[model samples]
Target chain A: MKGMTIIVKTITRWVKLFIFLFGIYVTLTGHLSPGGGFAGGVILACSFILLTLAYGKEYALSRLSLKTAKSLDSIGALIFLLTALIGMWVTNVFFDNVLQKLFPGTDFMLYSSGFIPLYNIGICLKVGAPLFVTFIVMAAMRIRINDKGEREIIQEEEEE
Target chain B: MFITEIYLLVLLVFMIIAAIIAVEIKSLISSVISLGAVGVGMSISFLFLAAPDLAIVQIAVEVLLLIFLIRATLGREIVSEKGAVTIPLRLLSIFIVLVILGFGIIAFRNLPEFGKPVFSLVPEAPSNSYIQHGLKETGSANIITAVILDYRGYDTLGEATVLFTSLLGALVILRAKTKKNGTKVINHKETKARGGE
Candidate 1:
């Protein structure tokens, strides 16, 4: 039984790693491909779900706490909004690409597109964190009724 | 006019069916699913009307809203018994559907040609050329990104603000308030009874 548990844990770890990497790939290639922040975020959230399923909620929460995830989500959202507001400062319109003055040339370079990549990253973080939080919180809230008809909230005890 | 009329008719039919399903479904989950379907159908209609931006926004918003709704509704006891669909209810739904469909068809008649490129009143600067150049220059292949972040960055920012507002709303709604007041506040008598058992 112990050996089986170890094997299961190993497999779950690999699955979570694969999902996380796939999410990165999707977000990076978003500009050149069909996928974008929405798809990438969903993929990233799926990795957390995999971790939660394989190792249990406690294990998952240990790695990525709900509080930390919520903070990251808020920060990402703020970054995205700030990027747009900065555009107004530069060009009198919100989100106008005034950063082109900082970059010399334009034509298929990473820095050439101004703040688009940054925007993508912001959206990726924003979408990924909330999605993971939604799944984890809901799963953690599950109540199990035992054979004795006693209801038990199946989660770790709150830490001091 | 011809193709537009045909497509409009098809969309009208879809809208009617979606409404009926949404109204008649016994299960709350199924009704929510139908509501999502209705949103998707409307987004498609928006796309048909040459509002790609609106369509994309509509689809994204609908998807997020559906996720939130599903999470909110999970584990709740669904009222299993559905009362009979009465005559007045049926007639009222039908009447509402007809009125909306008629209004939609009338609106469709006033729309511009589906394929015609309407000119913007703004200065005809090098927006198109800049977009073309962006494809080769930005190392990004997405035309939408080129237009959104490069040519029209301000609009993208507004879109981001909309997303931020939604995230804030979700946080407010889902935030855990007080800590679990010590695990169901066990009653002493009940605890003793259980101990005796």
Candidate 2:
């Protein structure tokens, strides 16, 4: 499956970067703003989905393969879990705001929140990668016609 | 403020209409678009309700859901086999709706008016304490963010695990299982010729 059109391709090339940057900004600013981990993650996934729609599945897969997506998904969850455990180890309480020293001086700054922003980043990656992978897999589903004219659902797994 | 209330009322009416269309439309794509419109209306209502956080999240999620819905049904032609709905079933649904509506009105009347919570319920809930102490305790300016990440971090972790499990399950079910050596893989290759296809 090739892309949609040349015009769309050109426009997507210019616009996708900004969309991605906006997603990052939202994820980082979760503690201070309306957009947070889940919201930003959806935006990031949308950028990738937009790429898939404009440039086709092959191109998007080339940029971020299924294996890489699976790894990122697990890594995100692991980081979130590890963050909680680290808090528990330090303060003897799970998910405690352990870093009290980093809290006061930089109030309202990017790194103001002790642990919330880190959690936000983890949630963003966890949500974004899996959402995009889900779309890619759904799009890869095909209806194949055999020599006997029997129709079957042919889901070709992505080769690493 | 009065003008905003009128606008909100109009938006609510449109939302109801869009929801009905979403449920009733024959074409899946049209129904999806109608649902998307309803989502947009809901986001706008959230904004008017002074919840920018909800408004942003609602619109972003709505966009992703629409994209998924459109992609899922894009190439597939709908096979329409109309089944006649029994009169009793339809009547039962209508009866249920009427009963729910009656109860809703009674509940609405019993409730405190907008912006005024019945203090008799919780007796000065932690909402006020959260906003006041959230900054010092959690060091986050956003009250909602503080509450979710610090106060209720365990719940967020549970939600994340749920998402991870859902994706893991979908991948496991969808991917084909392959066998090695001798006979063959358990779920590999439909035909010998098109194994790679």
**What lDDT would each prediction earn against the true structure?**
0.70, 0.84
lDDT of 1 by residue, A42-137 (tens): 898888877777777777888888888888788877877788778778778766555654664454444555667777777788888887877765
lDDT of 1 by residue, B56-113 (tens): 9999999998887776767665547779999999999999999999999999887767
Writing each residue's lDDT as its tens digit, candidate 2 over B39-145 gives 99999999999989789999999999998998887867656789889999899999999999999999999998788766535657777678677888888877788
Q: Give fnat (model 1).
A: 0.29
> Against the true structure, what is each candidate's TM-score?
0.54, 0.66
- Give the poorly placed runs of model 1, Cα more than 4 Å off: A1-8, A101-106, A143-160, B1-139, B147-197
Clashes of each: 9, 1
Clashing pairs in 1: A94-B154, A95-B153, A95-B154, A96-B154, A107-B136, A107-B137, A108-B137, A108-B138, A108-B139
lDDT digits (tens) for residues A105-151 of candidate 2: 37788878787888899999999999998887667754455556654
> Which predicted model would earn the best TM-score?
2
Q: What interface RMSD does every candidate have?
A: 6.4, 5.0
DockQ for each numbered candidate? 0.33, 0.30
